[model samples]
Target: MPVWPFKRSKADIDAKRLLEAVTQTSRQPALFGEGRIPDTLEGRFELMALNASLALIRLREAQGVESLAQAFTDKLFRLWDAGLREDGVGDLVVPKRMRKLAASFYGRLSAYGEALTSPEALATVIARNVFAAEAHAFAPALAAYAARTAETQAGGELDALFTSEGWPAYQG
Candidate 1:
């Protein structure tokens, strides 16, 4: 008997929702509008990190639901790993890539987590990571977007997420 997609486990359903939300958050046009965020690999990675940090932080705060968050993060990393392989990263260097990616994720997560607290902090972190201190041109817009997104994510419910089957409408 073939398994029906709608009959998936709660874990599977939640993972799908989380992935969709993350991708949608990353693609929010306000992010790239007027070049606030680059439309390149580095820019994409930074945007994903920002969204993941928000999701992970919220999940951690929800009592008894942290494991689900870990599962979601694991799935995202797995997708990244597969992408690396598809892009011609050798098997031998895959482990190294994983390590590098993990480090980058954690570092950005930490920076972004702190950055979300205030516009000043957000600007500093954004300048360091996204612009490499070259400029703070987009930091203000990016900070506003993060603040808005963080507010939206704050009201999301972990349990309800399993049944929420669509991509999020990101507001910048």
Candidate 2:
């Protein structure tokens, strides 16, 4: 079993919806008429984290690391909880259920320490180091959560949810 609550189930319809939701929500307004939605810091994090976890799962599997994928997810979820505790915003920032999904993704990525030092991480690295990396990897997932939130609060006006510069900032 995973150290976290990220159950080891095969990807399904829900996962597909979740992934699509992440992409739709993470999209920035068309950049310079390029029709390219800029990947916000949050979005970047989610993509990186998810991709890294996938990579780690592959690597571990190739090396015969038993249940490594499960372990990775568990660590990510644990770290996510820790990050929330350090910031004291678990309840404030995300709902309980969605938080689990986000945390599970985050936990999975965080498990790949060696991968963090690689060029891919370098390409994905933004402002901060470890913290930035972790946050960036979870950006898309967070965006999905935010999209869901916008839906609940304002019927999913995602464009309004994002800032003119691209991503939203904490008012406080």
Candidate 3:
């Protein structure tokens, strides 16, 4: 029998679809409802980082997810690059901007991963990132929402995720 391959073409396709799903979920208007989030570039990036953090963490436990995770991260940065280009950023500046964007994403990922270890920490992170100057009264709801999403994704399969219907509804 042949040895298992390090990369699977099908998995890559599914992962791309999954990345798109996560991206769409992150941009749901409900998340920005009633001034909850600023709905600007920073706000969109923050929400995407949060959703991507949760998805990547959950996806890491699945089989053959290594490449998928990396591809998802790449897709994220590609989106950032495209956005920069659309905003009239010069080619000379794109690389520097991408580096800064990557740093911002990694910083949020580290902070979020650390926070996910405890409810209190998660609340604090959410308050600081999501609410900013406002009170964190919604932290509990947000935490519950994140937990539900993780649980739902954990139970799902890669093929299922390729379909639009596979995505879990945002509970927050």
Best by TM-score: 1
Per-candidate RMSD vs. true structure? 3.4, 18.3, 5.1
Off by over 4 Å in 3: 1-8, 131-137, 158-166
Off by over 4 Å in 2: 1-41, 60-63, 90-172
lDDT of 2 by residue, 103-137 (tens): 65555455443433344433333213323444454
By TM-score, rank the candidates, best first: 1, 3, 2
Give each model a TM-score: 0.83, 0.30, 0.80
**Please, what are the lDDT tens digits per residue for candidate 3 over residues 1-172?**
6599565675567667877887888777766756366688778877788888877777666776788788778777888899889989999999999998888778777777777767777777877877774346766566666666666667776555555454566655
Candidate 1, 145-169: lDDT as tens digits: 7776666557765653333222244
Structure candidate 1, residue pairs in collision? none
How many backbone collisions does model 1 have?
0
